[model samples]
Target: MCGRNATAVYRFGRPGRVELTSAALTMAMRGFAGGGETQITAVNKDYRYTVFDRTSRTGFGEGGRHDTAMSSGLLIQRAGRTVAAKACSRDATVSAKAQAIIKPGPYVPH
Candidate 1:
């Protein structure tokens, strides 16, 4: 996993066998939040995410023009509902890191 300040590769295994380090996760969170204040709870999580590819071209030649693209990562939820994100969406790698954290499992606030 690549964090804001560090990178690591985790190999999952049997329960209690593989553990996610706090430092690595923190780095990733920092990258996602971009040094912005983040709030984590059983309800939701918030952060600042800037899109790398914010501009996109639409249509064709003459009329073709560049426009801002609007996109966001998948919605994460603990139960049967969707948890609202404060500021979500960034580059592909950052989105992947965010997804990894919200994957099915226990939530440990960093």
Candidate 2:
């Protein structure tokens, strides 16, 4: 697989170093508020994953050993829903573990 990240159709889970648009984020929140569930799949060749969301249910891995990470195992509040993902890579792929949420400050980047 190439060292650079690849972009493909947005799928739940297996969330790679992918970014979500604010509009999409809003929709996700709305779904949660409306008692709807959303799913996302991540595809990076190295590791792919699938994620499911629900209003009544907590973010990914709410059962045990909660790891708040943004990539696949990320858990953060967006729009209004608490999102979490599970991460996994190919045996040949290596990945860095990171926190899902980065507290925002007063300053916004341009």
lDDT scores of the candidates, listed in order:
0.31, 0.29
Error of 2 at 21 (Å): 14
Which candidate gets the maximum TM-score versus the true structure?
A: 1
Q: Clash pairs of candidate 1?
A: 1-8, 4-27
Residue-level lDDT of model 2, residues 1-110, one tens digit each, is 11223222333334574343221111112233324333333333333333333334334564663433222122333443434333434212112211112111221111
Q: For residues 2-110, what per-residue lDDT tens digits would candidate 1 score against the true structure?
A: 3342343332235688532222222212222112212222222342221121223333454654333433333234444444433344543334444445333233332
How far does residue 18 in candidate 1 sit from its true spot (Å)?
A: 19
Off by over 4 Å in 2: 1-34, 57-110
Q: Specify the poorest-scoring 10-residue window by lDDT in model 1.
A: 33-42
lDDT of 2: 0.29
Cα misplacement distance, residue 20 of candidate 2 (Å): 14
